[model samples]
Target: MSVLVRTEGRETAAGAIRPQAGLSTASRVAAVTVLTSLPVFLPGAANGLICAELGWSPVRMGAVLAVYWLASLSGAFVSRRAALPPVVERTLSIALFATCLGLLTAAVAPAVGLWISSAVGGYAYGYTQPHTNALLMRRCAPRLRAFAFGLKQAAVPTATLLASVAMPMLAGAGGWRLVFAGTAVLCGAGGVFLVRQGMRHGIRPGHSGARHPAATRDRGAPLRVGTFLVALSCAGFFGAMVGNGLGGFLVLALTTRGVSLSAAGAVATAGAALNIAVRLAMGWLVGRVPQVAWAALTGLFLTGAAGTALLTRPGLGAITVGALLAYGGGWGWAGLLHYAIALPYAGQEQRATAYSQMGVSLGAATGPLMCGLLFQLGPDAAWWALTAAGSAAGACVLVARGHVGPRPDAGVSPARRRPRDSPRPA
Candidate 1:
């Protein structure tokens, strides 16, 4: 039988058998995520090496990271109610190249280099999600959406892991400039590859790219600001605060406790690896039992809160264990959160994702800056603040759940269902 390629998959002419195209799309999404995420994380991961060269303090490190998060807020404006496939394709393509350019700038420029690099990279980071999430909603099957989101989000920790493991070693071997230059080349190549892969799915390049069937169909009604969205944003904000606040300084904090830079990076690497596993597992589980998604998120938040509290202990063993818990549990809900939003919202995925990103970016920006100040007061103070943020995230999830209506099992939005169809999870 002849193969018929759909927007997201390839099916036999009979339509009973599906090919690997869907997996290919999901893989590309994850790849792009890793590339986009890597730059923001590099500053934190290689802070010791970078700071030694620039003579930067923890506060300056925090500022550089915060600027990236703050710049991400621009995504909301760029992606406002944009449902077209061309827009998604173009924005993401530009974001990728921009990310590479920023890295290249950092590699070559002088003392002010990192600041410029952070802003440019931050802009790219901000523009990435609305498009990527839109692509996922269009391509992935409804049944697998949560898992696909999981796989996509897993790239974040994957990036962190790469940064933790590779950046320090690369800097040590060839200087930090070599690290950014190498990364820029990698990102640039990734962008080209993604654009090519997108062609099969009808996501062509340039201002006049071909449209996907999903995006060409009805452009859904604009997403309105409402209580549920507000609660979701709050949850994201608090969650990011806990995650980024501690995570940004994890290596430095470890070093302060007497671990060497290489050893600290190894610790961070282990934590990131654990985080990757947790996010992937949560995504897989939530995809099957979507009804419990919110509860799962709340549990993760509480678990992370406990983990952050563990950071208050003085021993290296305590610090190591705490970092693992904080990384794995505290920071694992993002994919699930985006999946939950995408599942019910369907057509409004881009706008909805963008809305949430704004809150997340602001919190990420605030968290590191606040934690840097707290670290000056003392590391324990910073850790405690992160613990509080995690607890608050759990509370926000509970509030969001309360607002989801009494029939949690009926996961479909009331407005989306037909009158005769029985209500059920999407």
Candidate 2:
């Protein structure tokens, strides 16, 4: 069963007061996110096999991935005006079903099927992102909210790790088609479970949670797009270029270095594992020390830059160390960033998440394209591009901090409000 917590009107020096979100609810949200994320990253994980069979170059593979991010970018922009489903379960189920369908479609013809399949997957990811954020924002305790976001965002690397580990073995066993088909089956099963839970929870179709038009309007209020928010999102854009580029190309880069596919996948898996651990740790740190959130993000990007520089060095030892640092420190702070962004917004988490997602999508789309273009110049050139992007992202975070630093409580301090008479469902 899911537990919901409504934020009290009162605000503290730390943040708003609310109960912790149920573990089951958070787990479901993460699972749905992982399922939706798979289609976008799977192409990268299985690029070698797919390219070998289809005669496509790395540039063409990058283009395919770009299409997916572009579709997500478009959807994120559109979500600014879209209404979320009444319940989180409905949204998660829809995303899961869409992901399942996309995977199944890609299984039919891994080559031509990728275009449409990836778009569908991207749409599902973009569509569900903000709704899930809003759900966590409304239901999670402010004290632990960063941790919740960390756990949720960890799903992305989890998907990438699963893809990196599973793709090669599955492809080797029965070719790439089997991999997609198997993933689709898993997605469909998850969808079914969510559907059943939604029904059991009394969230039937056409059941509007809002009692009046005014309440609905209030829930979908226009977003406050401030200069500070824009700067922060732009920082995310730059950081994603490095983070996503790292995940998308790590295996291929290692293969070029004369490592076996299985071994390369193992290295990628280690990076992803470290990434997951760091995200959770960062979230916990920021939640305990809210004052350090922005500063921690800035440091993460800088560390990512240093890691990218290491990748430019020769030998598997350098590559392994670089991948761990790059993936762990560089990409681990997304959940904290989201938590920080949503804290000041109070009730507008969905709209806030949409805008942030747009920046990430734009960065994700452009990053791989830039890397692929430079790939022809040699692997070091691609790594250098990522290094530069990571550094720029760190600078952007510093700019954002400057905007927030002068204000009381670092400018994100929630305004105090009158306490409610009693708690209620959010």
Candidate 3:
């Protein structure tokens, strides 16, 4: 079902055999990571407020975002071919510009205008991943790659945390429109910076994989890669279903659980902080025992299910703990998940990452929309639906792991630490 190779490299307390990523490369990766996600959540942070003020139904809200997420998926695929800079520079510039314009549209436009922004923003959101990963694949060292990926993944919650903090302040200062306008300006500047940064760094001519003569091998051949891709796709579908569901709805969900609008934003903020911590933790955890990283999904999903159920109760303490588990535990796997998939197809990390993203986009697009429909039945039912989704997602990952054929490095997993000698037969 799958193959594993001994890890090409790793970093440690002793020293790194592979060269480490220098400060400049690391900073660039981090900056790109943050900028890519920041714009996506600017609108999301105020989703609940928008609904409350306009009396827009969740169904409509979810539908518009579903359209947005789908568009983002397309963006990833589109960016797949344009792997090098200048071309990449133009692509990112266009994407960020579109995001800026879309946010402007959302700020002033009516219902139809909101939908238009959804498509525009979604396109940019989708394109960011493949290209960004491609850059990292080339720049980051094998030893440091997993941690880099994990830290980069933390951008999601960082973006969410910013949105949470900004929304409440912006709403009070100048209403929500000011938030969109301000975020647009930030995104526009970020667009310019992204392109300039690449030029400054002296980007190489070719895309990754084939670009590096040594990395040219299609590490996992067509059938093998295809099967795992399908499996990871299913993983993306359900895992992202849960993660995005929480991201898109946590503040809104908290409000229904008796939280004040202002307080709900705080709860969302707390959840985002915990989410970042867990993603970093997952990075370290997998770096130690990557072969088993896929297995960790089961634990995270179950935690999400428990967390979602906890939220159905009626207390602030429960709400906080639940959000930590749901957001921290449920949503933390993304970085590790992406890293795991990329390790197998290191050469084609960009395109491989895109396949995984398709699963994520599919789930993200539908998760909220499905939950919106469930909310009509009652709030508890929605939580139950999330629980079901988490459970299903966990099963998909476990199944994927099982399908994997043991590679030589399988024994390197921490789980296989049994002693070779049996006490010399005592």
Best of the candidates, lDDT: 2
Candidate with the larger TM-score of 1 and 3: 1
Query: Across residues 1-426, which tens digit of lDDT does each residue of candidate 2 receive?
Result: 232222222223333433433445566678778888888888888887888988998778778888888888887788767765555676667777888888888888777788877898898888778778877766556566777888899999998878877987778989887898898998888888877766776444564343422224356456657665787788779888988888777878889989998899788888889999999898778767777777788889888899999998988898889999899877887887776666655555667778788888899998877887788788899898999888988887776666554444563333311112111224
Higher-scoring candidate on lDDT, 1 or 3: 1
**lDDT tens string, model 1, 59-175?**
677778788888887766576555444424445666778889888988898367678778888878777787677666665555566677888889987887788678757788898
Name the runs in model 1 displaced over 4 angstroms.
1-19, 196-220, 254-266, 314-317, 405-408, 412-426
> Per-residue error at 401 for model 1, in Å?
1.6
Candidate 1 pairs with clashing backbones: none
What lDDT score goes with residue 93 in model 1? Answer: 65
Comparing 1 and 2 by lDDT, which wins?
2
> Lowest-lDDT window of 10 residues in candidate 2?
416-425
For model 3, state the Cα shift of residue 389 in Å. 1.6
Q: What lDDT score goes with residue 356 in model 1?
A: 80
Clashes of each: 0, 0, 2
* C-alpha lDDT of all candidate models, in order: 0.72, 0.75, 0.66
Flag clash pairs in model 3. 2-405, 72-126
Clashing pairs in 2: none
lDDT of 3 by residue, 113-161 (tens): 5777778877777776766665554555555556666777887778767
RMSD, one per candidate, in order: 5.0, 5.2, 7.8
Query: After superposition, which runs of candidate 3 have C-alpha atoms over 4 Å from their true positions?
Result: 1-27, 38-40, 48-58, 79-90, 108-113, 200-211, 219-225, 257-264, 288-292, 313-316, 411-426
How does model 1 score by TM-score?
Answer: 0.85
